[model samples]
Target: MKKILLPALLLIVLALAACGNKQEEPAKEDTPSKEQGTSDTITYQSEEGPVEVPANPQRVVVLSSFAGTVHEFGVNLVGAESWSKDNPSFDSFLKDVEEVSDENIEKIIELEPDLIIGLNTIKNIDKLKEIAPTVTYTYGKVDYLTQQIEIGKLLNKEKEATEWVDAFKARAQQAGEDIKAKIGKDSTVSVIEEFDKQIYVFGDNWGRGTEILYQEMKLAMPEKVKEMTKKDGYYALSAEVLPEFAGDYIILSKSDTGDNSFLETETYKNIPAVKNDQVYQVNTAEFSFNDAYTLDNQLDFFIKSFLGTK
Candidate 1:
């Protein structure tokens, strides 16, 4: 009985020792199921539920003023809408990209975009999805820098995108400091654009408004500018009320070529900006809310107009 018990104990000890000498978990299978991120749909937070995108969206279409944001991720955009000239706060190099147009929906469909980007309130999201997977963004409603960061997450380039923004912030800070020293601390500024319907003075909450108030030439925003928000946060005002919205200096944005000789109207001549030559007309189609290529132009424009010699 003792002999049998000793042999059994020896066998059990050998089995326990064998179990302790286990191997690794077969290198985790090297499969998508083992990955932390989703294998099917890449998820992103939005106004609605999680916005899902394909894993490797090769052909992409962008219809927002976030061309810089997408460009930060090193994505070779298959399609992009023309740069929005209405908001001069963004980079303008995007205008040179030959982006697609909403009017040419048939052309966009032919591109076979894997992902379509648009503002959260884009006109035809449902229709866009019928042609491709669309991701809606609340762009104009948020801060300019915030929009860039959020889009970074969507593109799975959060780290790289943040680096780009950090560089941009540095650029903004340096530009602001330089312009402040050149323009003098007492200087004030305003921005106005003539849209299809009416003239608009960008508000602090919007892109161009924020750029003037916070970036570029640092200046105090008048109370009238804040009131111009009008609930939805932006409103168009008639140029007749230029005095009401006018500041010590006004940066006027115009569509198409930079020539403003055509706008020598009687009313335009009387405005303090035009009268004193305090109004500087910038080419919107080339710069506003554009992309990296033209961002230097905006920065330079601020320097030349409000700051000093280039």
Candidate 2:
């Protein structure tokens, strides 16, 4: 009876030791079960409504003016609109990017873009949405800087976009101060573009560096331009009235293809800015948009053009 009791006690001790060892062992991590799902998309609150977009967009197509802004965010652009493609400043980066338009549904389909951006005016919106998450913006719905921030939110790069915007504003302000010191505090500036056989002057928000010239830099706009373009943001006039809109300094944006004969006429040639060689000519395609890339370029151009410093 004693031997049987000892054997029973020993067996109990061994069992208790085994339990302690098991308890001390590290737990195996839980593996995902078949019922679990990993979502690779996020909901973006676009102007139209809430839409699901890839959390990390691999291929993107831009069908409007935001190409440069998107490109500045380090996004991979597979296709872009003709205007963006035609921009000489974008040539190096967009060399491999295909030129696409709102009308090119079949072509865009072939690109298999995970994202599509365009203006609200684009046709085939529904079809584009079927192909991928499509986001559109109504022009002038927001200020130029806010527009960039909006795109940053859409792309999940708001932090980066905000950083850029802040830094840019500071730099532009400094540049403006430097320019004012050199050109005088009250010297006025104007932005004019020649297109479709007509001459147009722009307000502060209009592209072609108007934002930098008037808004960011706080430079004075010619009273005539301010009066006419105050409501429309831009005004079209015959070449005869060009002098009325002329300022101490002029930024002339002209397309090589447009009828630029007006620039040769005495009416335009006699403008104070032109006669004083204060006119800085830029390509319409290059200076047309207020995107990050274009804005940086525009700012640099202004610094160099005004101060003769790179």
Candidate 3:
């Protein structure tokens, strides 16, 4: 009777151990099953169509001039185009990032980026695709506010981008009110730049702060200036005829040797803005930047230059 009782007890112990082992098996399977369901990538619909990009891209490469926007979004940038490299705000980032160009496909491959970004107008899309999943944006496909939001979506940071947009708009709107009070509500603001032999007036997009001076600040534009440049992004002018486009206030941007000594010339000096000392000369390379970082700096400049408050 004692031997029979011992054997039955042994069988019960084995049965309990088997149940414990079965319980552990499901936990081990849970992790891999989750991984299989949610892979490393998320599908982002690009202009080229839907493409799977790393959900959290670690190494990013930008093949266009919009690197500043990427950096502002707090992404890891391994490579970028050097259009804004000289800007002091970008000096630190440029130090660590490789300067990429269309001709430098080999260098891009060496960087081993998880993703590559470029303008839709960028060449070598097929070659770039061989390296990694690539996304492209059209140059004027959207305004600055919408473009940033779109970029955030592409990078899987939509919430962050939306937060920034809301905050920036609030600040910009307030700045606009201040500007109107200080500079007069009816005052017209003009954005003009000199590049090489050309003198051009700009519209609300691009890098001339038109969005800030005109759109956000509620500033008016000279009718002739508006008629000429409202459709085209810019209008070219001869030095002699610049007075026609001059406004109550003018923001002048000059590139290296691009000014053509126009500021010193009687034609430019005779403009009402020049005589009233309302023409603000901003660094062309600096002002040409239209990214999130540059916009913040420019807003401060407008307030100080026009409102005399820091």
Winner by lDDT:
2
Question: lDDT (CA) for every model shown?
Answer: 0.54, 0.75, 0.68
- For candidate 2, the TM-score is 0.86
Q: Which predicted model would earn the best TM-score?
A: 2
**Ten residues in a row with the worst lDDT in model 2?**
9-18
Clashing pairs in 2: none
Task: Tell me the lDDT of model 3 at 281.
Answer: 82
> TM-score order of candidates, best first?
2, 3, 1
In order of listing, the candidates' clash counts read 7, 0, 0
What TM value does model 3 have?
A: 0.84
Instruction: Show the colliding residue pairs in model 3.
Output: none
How well is each residue in 223-260 modelled by candidate 3, as lDDT tens digits?
87888866545667898999999999999876664546
Tens digits of lDDT, candidate 2, 201-264? 7777666787788878889999999888766567788899889989999998877888999988
The Cα RMSD of model 1 versus the native structure comes to: 21.3
